[model samples]
Target: MTALGPLPPTAAVRLVKEAVQDAYADYGSEASRWLDGFTRQGGQVFCGAGCFGCCNMPIRLSLAEALIVRDALNAEKLAAVEAHARQVLANARTAPDEDVYVRRHRLEVGYCPLLDRATGQCSEYESRPTRCRDTFSAFPARYCTEGYWESLSPRDKRQYARDVARTPGTDGELHYIAPLEYLSEPVWEAAAGAMDRAFGLQVWGDFWVLVSLSARPDFMAAVEAGDGRAALKAAQAAGLSHPMILEIE
Candidate 1:
């Protein structure tokens, strides 16, 4: 057999790109299959594409998700995202951690920042978190937890509250409903880590901070400054789009 030679740098880069693309395609296919199954089992559950109910909430995301959003933003978008993040950071500093849950629930009544008011759809759908992806309709058997709640029955709700207390990450908010079981935590975490490594640290941290900061107005304004396109890119890179906060104010 002929001896193999070292590949050129350009060829290697192309190979890596192909590999990444393949992996993404495979993972996306799997995720789509799972979502399809979940949707089917729950009897055709959908939040409606134009419905912005979930976008208005102060949803939490893993660091990797943050990076994906940041990378999606160009220079202008990066600035906007950063400014929004700072605003959120300011608010988070004063608010009691428990109170945040309450605020998140009420936010559904208001407009969401990422929402396109005219369309009622999230502007950034591709980069949304797994939590958003996994949310299913209120079907008990097909869905992960059908009647697991505190709102339906007082005694059941109280018991659920006690159970949540024992569970570290479980939230006890009025509109807060989780679709998946506890085991999903590790799976999502691993997915997030893989995303982080695929992107760079700068992209990841910027996305994380911006989403966290979208609750603040002052910061978002900073992002909205400069050339509109440039500002949008900067804000997006920083995860700083907080027009929703301004609307509420």
Candidate 2:
């Protein structure tokens, strides 16, 4: 309700708690029963603690995810979010051309502004992005480092992404990254990119993540109006080359 900013630690905790409580009222009891059944039915696996590994991965999220994140962020916490954006921009500007892909593969520097460093856990763990909540390790039987892709060569990683995006039959998966190379689905990507352009979060990353973030009301409005492209052209006309608009498919 209050102006969002960099929220204080206590405030962040309170927001997360409130959100989780509301969700519990809606689905918690049923979902918990299901999870219990899943665990009992030989679904239990890794039990590592203090694993910041998964938090660092370039996990894609939906626009709803960004809204949830923004809604959870208190006034004080907004500062941290803004700072993160600034830092990302700075990194992009200074990175050498050849190293551009390499830099992106590296884990985002520093703990997420949303994390509680003292506990080494997400302060909003309960209300964390759905992708984070849903993803599981292929080898849950083994304790694997979560940000495993950080070690991959940029070219190989991009190629793999392309393959996944081009491959068929993954609509049922809870979380999957967009393959950058192949374009199996065009209209979806274009619309998603338009949404990203509307939001001013046009930087290339995970397509789904960008599209999901761009689905914010404001972003959706601009994109649906078909004026987001106009805005881009105007920005370019004003001498801003390479504006941070979404990459259209």
Candidate 3:
């Protein structure tokens, strides 16, 4: 973790914002190429409206990405996101394990905070993080439902097999797709490096928690005063520690 010790608060934020824009632009081009290849190979994409299965699962984002999302929201949406984040953080604090907490949250909540309940679409679709953009399924949308995975108990492998057999649409197999896999190693490495350099730490965590924390006036103030480390620590203290930060290798 390289530290960019004390500078103006907006300096890092500006750098991160610029890096996020550049990275997402590159990611868009790379993702389009992958989709084109999949189509060329006669593969059909099943992701579309009313298919919010993937949204129910946890989505992580870099600090820079989260900041961008925060900047894009209006007052009303930001308030809703804050309320949702409080619930998520409260739930996470009581769970015995982070993974279990997230799984249970998905089962109970069943949608991302950023998702529009009425239309079943992302509110900030244009500025969505790479994690959302990269997610796709080679199988039909029905097979991708969270219920298929969440309903099965860990002890019931046989029951799981039977359930899979009973499920229609899928050919009793799962083939998930991630366009990031097809991106060049150098491209990903550059993106990762850019995030690390901009944020001082190789920070990545749950999108909802990150966005909620980023929307905080105090957190932004701390970061603007050249104390992003303190802002992140405050987030951790507030139960935003799950999906812990990772090293940019």
Candidate 4:
């Protein structure tokens, strides 16, 4: 391969978009293959279409990925995204750090803004962030549910093991989603690298928050302007997201 240096700003932006898209598509394919092989080796994956248990958590995304999500939304959905972003920011104000925000915010806020409460489904499944895409439960759906794991008694744990043993092809132990995570990291790295080159920084954070910011024309302009500092300033000015979440560097 030929050695390469930086491209023009516009070209870099386009490449980042492509990188994220490729990452999304690539993970889907690899996940399917991985699940197939694991299942063939007696692994059971509990992730089904209607299980939105993991949807309540904060999803992190880069500016490019967030923009993809933003473009996928309609006006009403965008409104919901902004509303959810505001809630995240509000809740974040009290929390001293991202860990606190993540732990407390999900329980307080509940359900992703993109989730349809009526049915446990992502409203914008196709355009979901890479983090959301990577979510596959190795444990039971209840594991994803808040307080479910804590509520489980010792007997309940044994019972679950027994049930897994009884179930065909399962080995009475949790399956691993690490392979999927392994696959997801590179995509994000590619996206982050692209964003760094194009936007002069990799601005990323909570999914809804970043998506909401990406929907802003001013924010997008700042990002595309290839000035990282200006983009960071615009992110702070939004006042709808916490710096901890809407990080720019």
Candidate 5:
């Protein structure tokens, strides 16, 4: 078998970023077509500006996406992001499990660190990750709130079903949810697959974790030199090895 070697870190990073950007563009076109189909079928989209209920959830990103986001931030914003990432990592360490950790992170943070509190907008709106751009609520926007769903009991769930059944345009049908994962998962998979094949390394993780690691001087230097193992070690040292690391298959 021929031996495979890593591309120079700079080249690898560039390839990954380009692949992800291309994937994003493809996703945009696919999502638009899907949404159009949904609308044609009498489905209505309720997501709009100022509706940030879904922003509190954990967001995963490919290395390429993280690098793009990191590069777009100014020094002050980068510092804030680093601080927030540290807190997130700390919380991740103490939680009983991944689910518990994610829920706690949502409740504690209440919004993405990059979110503008006053405007309820992403600071890097134009360059926001694909996951963020793809998220949309099929039901009423209020139901999408973290607190609202977390508070739901069995009875509440039943009542919600009843209420949804009664709502106009939703009779016996699912509301026009964004189908975020359905649409984007393939894009992510393709991007990850391409990166892995190109770099001979796993290359997917939480957005903040990846972004934080990309900011490390040594980490980037190692990556620039096409040393995947060294870059992975740097990420591990920074406490980003958990849920962030995807399966190698």
Candidate 6:
């Protein structure tokens, strides 16, 4: 916090990643033990390598994570990201709330840019954003598919629940690996602190929204120079500031 003299977005990303590295590692170890204990009690984890059904939705992230994503992408994937971001941005333009945005983005905007459509796998699996890494499903992969879940009637849901090792949350969402979420929280906290110290404000939001902002050298420069207005102006012009899509505060 002491030496924050106009650091570049890249520098901020390093700070964020480094800040969370050990915490993430600890979370992984704890999560493994927790999973072992959980499954011993007849619980289950249905998320697997080929299950990319959860990828087709709106997800939030910090600018530093976005930069990691930008750096990880190739030219083709970069273009794909921009294209997907445009749809996400467009969907945000009229979305009444996050729920609507998530559903619309899932069924409308469709799969993630990095998703391998044929194999139902993430191409950038290793360097994927925090949100992607955070989300996990304890239910059958088909349950993770929003459309399939939506098609189930109330009675059908009840009947299915009777036979499943359910860990239902507030929204009937099956509890994902609970420990996985703990790891991502520190990353967000570190990213928020790093962004705040570097630019005097924080940029956090939907993954594509952050990616759009991160890829723009002008946007990056504006924030690096502590020019929030210019950065906000640029992002707004591109329709990336819908409250659901992003927050530059």
Of candidate 4, the 10-residue stretch with the lowest lDDT total is: 1-10
**Which ranges of candidate 4 are over 4 A from the true structure?**
1-13, 96-99, 153-176
Kindly list the per-residue Cα lDDT of model 1 for residues 110-129, writing each as its tens digit. 33345578987766777655
Model 2 over residues 1-249: C-alpha lDDT tens digits? 112332222332233334434543344454455446656766442434454545544444333244446556555665555455444444445556635623453444434667776766777776565445544432232223434556658995776566545433223231232121122233224324443444433333332233232323333343234555653443233222132312322
| Worst 10 contiguous positions by lDDT, candidate 3 | 1-10
lDDT against the true structure, per candidate, is 0.42, 0.42, 0.64, 0.74, 0.69, 0.71
lDDT of 3 at 69: 81
Judging by lDDT against the true structure, name the best candidate.
4
List the candidates' TM-scores in order. Answer: 0.48, 0.48, 0.75, 0.83, 0.81, 0.84
Residue-level lDDT of model 5, residues 138-210, one tens digit each, is 6878776666766889898788777666544443343435364577876677667756755555556667666
lDDT of 4 by residue, 45-158 (tens): 788888888788877788778767776777777877778787888888898776777777768877887788888888888878887877666677877776775688999878
Q: Rank the candidates by lDDT, best first.
A: 4, 6, 5, 3, 1, 2
* Candidate 3 stretches greater than 4 Å from native: 1-9, 150-174, 179-192, 221-229, 236-249
In candidate 5, which residue pairs clash?
A: 9-223, 9-224, 9-226
Q: lDDT tens string, model 6, 177-205?
A: 55568646877777778778877888778
Give me the displacement of residue 121 in model 4, in angstroms.
1.3
Q: How big is the positional error of residue 177 in model 4, measured in Å on the Cα after superposition?
A: 1.8
Give the better candidate number (2 or 6) by TM-score.
6
Task: State the lDDT of candidate 3 residue by residue for 53-157, as single tens digits.
Answer: 788876666767777787788766676666666666666667788787767777775577778878889889987876777677665676567567656577665
Better of 4 and 5 by TM-score: 4
Which of the two, 1 or 3, has more lDDT? 3
| Candidate 1 displacement at residue 137 in angstroms | 3.5
After superposing candidate 6 on the true structure, give the runs of residues whose Cα lies further than 4 Å from its correct spot.
Answer: 1-10, 20-23, 160-175
